[model samples]
Target chain A: MREQFDIPEGVIYLDGNSLGAPPKHVAERVQEVVKHQWGNRLIRSWSEGWWEAPQRIGDRIGRLIGAAPGQVVVGDSTSVNVYKALMGAVKGTERTEIVCDESTFPTDGYIAQSVGELTGLKVRAARPSSLDLTEDTAVVLLNHVDYRTGALHDMKALTEQAHDVGTQVVWDLCHSAGVYPTQLDEIGVDYAVGCTYKFLNGGPGSPAFIYVPKHKQATFENPLSGWNGHRAPFAMEASYEPDPGIARARVGTPDILSMLALDAALDVWDGVDMKAHWARGMTLTSLFRSYIEQMTSLEVITPNTLPRGHQISVRCENPAGVMAELIARGVIGDHRPPDILRFGIAPLYIGEQEVKRAAEILAEIVN
Target chain B: MREQFDIPEGVIYLDGNSLGAPPKHVAERVQEVVKHQWGNRLIRSWSEGWWEAPQRIGDRIGRLIGAAPGQVVVGDSTSVNVYKALMGAVKGTERTEIVCDESTFPTDGYIAQSVGELTGLKVRAARPSSLDLTEDTAVVLLNHVDYRTGALHDMKALTEQAHDVGTQVVWDLCHSAGVYPTQLDEIGVDYAVGCTYKFLNGGPGSPAFIYVPKHKQATFENPLSGWNGHRAPFAMEASYEPDPGIARARVGTPDILSMLALDAALDVWDGVDMKAHWARGMTLTSLFRSYIEQMTSLEVITPNTLPRGHQISVRCENPAGVMAELIARGVIGDHRPPDILRFGIAPLYIGEQEVKRAAEILAEIVN
Candidate 1:
């Protein structure tokens, strides 16, 4: 699996949680899309395959996230999709409040705040475990895994709690989609949005995905209803009637060049099993954490009681300076503001040896 | 400029109105970005220019649209940007209506309807000329050029009219941005959104641009407020505070691959004057229209009383069949539903000979 990525020589990249490294063949495939499909075939390429790439590639992502075929469609940034999902959740309901995880990725919190303002719902912040769900709660936005702490939240339990209160759940899967086996279908998550550029290795800022299950498809009102989502997009109709399927999640013209790049990138996951892949990720993180605890005085901030995510974060003094020193020595990790250093263990391309070496380098810098 | 694009060997690509021909150098530039920048550098590429790409590429596009630097920021689909611009316009106003052009490109109309629904503003459709200007109108959404017909609207006059009624105006420049010299700064247009993939030749489904002039920047309230628009995006602040300038329009992580391709495509417009470029488009359309009128019984639907846009639309029976037959002969124009056949004369890659050849072929097929 490590042979599948174009990892730079002598560089121990532990930032897959921030931006995954590129797959070895994505560059060649993207070039072919640029030269042959876009350059030569031009507009005819849209009908040829480009028009359906969103749903097609979305199914590829769906396989990993436990969404059945036609349940996911990819396009737009996660922020835009967050807005759509939150807005779509409260459509005909009389609920007047949106409950959001207090510690969420800023974009999700900000987008949820905006949705609350637009729909006249008050947004309240609370821990996922203690959401204080009520019948008046229109929707709850939760991050499957905390971005800063790498603590995995129990999606199934939280969703059931919200459902018990007759409220929908919108999960921000940015940190968990490819890292963890998020069974969106089994959990019956109302809506989910995730970025491909992180654990999926779909280049920088590749478009995000929106999971709109079959049950929610008919009633899903996409607020940013672009022509592409219309029943007959080519008909150029004035009235907006959404497609009666997963494609209602689509908003506007897809970013094709990036989308095709992502389609190619997904080929790397073809024969990989999510459960086994995530198990290997745990092994690698466990090994790395053991070395860090033994060699450094820094405190691991990633909660041990909770199921861990793909990354491990450690609290240390002058963490940005420590990360800069570590990167200078070829150990690539990112630092959150103030005092936390984060390292991600990507099961596909990253292996035991690389994670061990990264921990050793980090221990040297912190000491 | 024709040589700068990889126009297919035997196709008269008149569908630049729908999707522009890919620039030849864009393939190589994107390949390098995928290979060297993303593959080798990985997350390091964010600081190595990826982070600032939306605003940087936006400033280059601003040069063509008569906006200075620090005004236009590019990302998201035109549908998403329409929501931002419209919602940004009616922030502190007490107006209760949003006036949209009845014949707008469907995405603009659909997005306007959604925005009106969310903001509690009633959406009313009217011709740009006959819009009932009133103090109650919050914002007027107008297309600089009609998508179905190639009629250009008067921005200066309509903007002045909307201003007199204390209503802000949002212009949709999908059909006119790169072909006509849209003086957004000079006209003091309240807000505007445009597609990059059309006359800009920014590849298929390239991200769209949003223009928020200096004055509007202070008062513009981006409803889809993602953290990327935050004053300190990297700070990961919980409360949303928009950046003081055009960056406030940015909502989320940019689509870097498509955006870089657009940045490379904009190089084709380096020394070309928009005024002279639009003059040539008019000349080409005139020559094509004259040939079609002389040889075929098609009714040119683009009004002669109004200023023409880059394309020429002709109404004929079974227009889709006629367009298919025309495409079969390698003349690639598109049909808009029941009647209209649209041909776009992109001055950069299209010229006198290709336009003439396309017209002669269309005449033969129609007759």
Candidate 2:
């Protein structure tokens, strides 16, 4: 599996959580899609393959996330999908408050705020564990994996608590999906949105996927109701009639080129053992944390015993300077502003050896 | 310029208005972007070039559309951009109606309807000539070129009229942008949204561009205010504070792959004369209309005396069958149901010879 991605030589890339290294097969697949499917077939390719790409690729992503068929459709950016999911979850509800956390990704929080502003709902920010869900709570937006600290929230427990208070839950799985398995359907999550550019190893800014359980699909009203979501998009009707099921989640023309790149990148997970993959990620992160603790004066911010995702974060005095030095030494990680140095341990292409090399370099730079 | 495209041999592609043929440079550019920039550079590529692609490519597109340097930024699908532009235009206005026409693209009307539904405004659909704009009209969404008829609207006259009634105007430049010269700033348009895939020869479903005038940029409030539009996106702020200029029009991480393809596609227009391009387009479309009128019994629905864009539509019996036969004979055009065969003449790659060949095939198939 390590051979599947095109990680550059002499560079220990630990920034897979920001932008996953492109898969080795993506170049050839994109070439075929660009030259043969698009250049040769021209407009006819829309019907032949392009039209169904969102749903088709969505199904593959759904399989990885433990979602049922027809419940996931891939399109738009994660931020846009976050808006749609939040809107769909809150519509038709008398509840007027959207419950979110301060630690969620900036875009997710901004989208929640925008949704609140648009719909006249109150956006309530609370700690993840202390979300005081009440009858006024329309939607609970939570991230499965913390983008800064790699803290993993218990989705099932949080969703149950939200449901106890009659609040729908929408999960932002940007740092979690494809890093590990998610039982969204089993957990009864009302809506979920995730990006492919990170742990999924889709090319940069590839389209994101949204999950809407089967029961919610028929009545889910995406606010960005574009013609592609129509029951018969080719009919050219002036009126907006959303297609039934997850297809209605689609808002515009599918980015065929990037979508195909993601489709090719997803081939790496065809028969992947996701549970084993998650375990390997844990092992690598734990080893990196131990090495850093033993060798450097930096403090690990990610909780050691808590359920976490594939990344680890450490606190340093000057993260920007340290990160610049690490990159100069061919160890590529990122610094989330202020003082956090984050390293992502992607199990597919990244292994224990890469993790050890990265830790060694970080220790040298920090000391 | 015809030699700059990778049109399939033996096919007279007359559907550039539907989906422009892929540029010869696109495949190579996409490969380099995928394998080198994304695969090797990974997260660093965002800082290297990916972060500015939307605005950079948008400035290139702005040059062709007669917009100022900082007035345009590209991201999102055309439908999504339509929603953003309409939302930005209608916000804070006391006017209650969104004026549009039946000839607008279905997605445009649907987006207008969605906007009306979201904002509690009435969507008034009427003929372009009888828009009936009053002080009550908040925003008027008009297509510069009729999608079905190829009739070009007088942007200057209509925009001035809308302004006279105190209505903001949003132009859908899908059919006009790359096909001819558009003086968006000179016309005093408030907002403009257009797709790059059609005449611009961007790959299928390439991200769309939105233009907001320099003066209007400060007050334009796109409802889908994601974090990318933030003043400091990397700051991880919880509140939504939009960035100052046209950069605020960007909603999310750009589709870098498609953006790069569009960037390469736009290179075909570099240093080329837009006036000359429009003249060649007019000449080719004129020849096509004359050839079809002379050789076939089909009625040319596209007006000859009226100003037109790149495409010409003809009304004929059994258009679906005729189009299928024509396609089999290597004359590639599209049929809009209830009997219209649409032919697009893109002067960038299409010429008078291809137009004549398509007309001959249409005559053979129809007769």
DockQ for the candidates, in order: 0.87, 0.85
Q: How does model 2 score on DockQ?
A: 0.85
Clashes of 1: 0
Writing each residue's lDDT as its tens digit, candidate 1 over A2-71 gives 8989988999989999899888899999988888998888888999999899999999999999999999
lDDT digits (tens) for residues B1-367 of candidate 1 = 8888898889999999989988899999999999899988888899999989999999998998999999999999999999899888877679899999999999999998888877788999999879998999999999999988899999999999999989999999999988888899999998999999998989889999999999879988898898889999999988888899889999989989999999999998999999998988888888888888888888998876536798999998898898889899998888897789999888888888998888889878877
In order, what fnat does every candidate score? 0.89, 0.84
Every model's TM-score: 0.98, 0.99
Q: DockQ for the candidate 1 complex?
A: 0.87
Give the TM-score (vs. native) of candidate 1.
0.98
lDDT of 2 by residue, A142-177 (tens): 999988899999999999999998899999999999
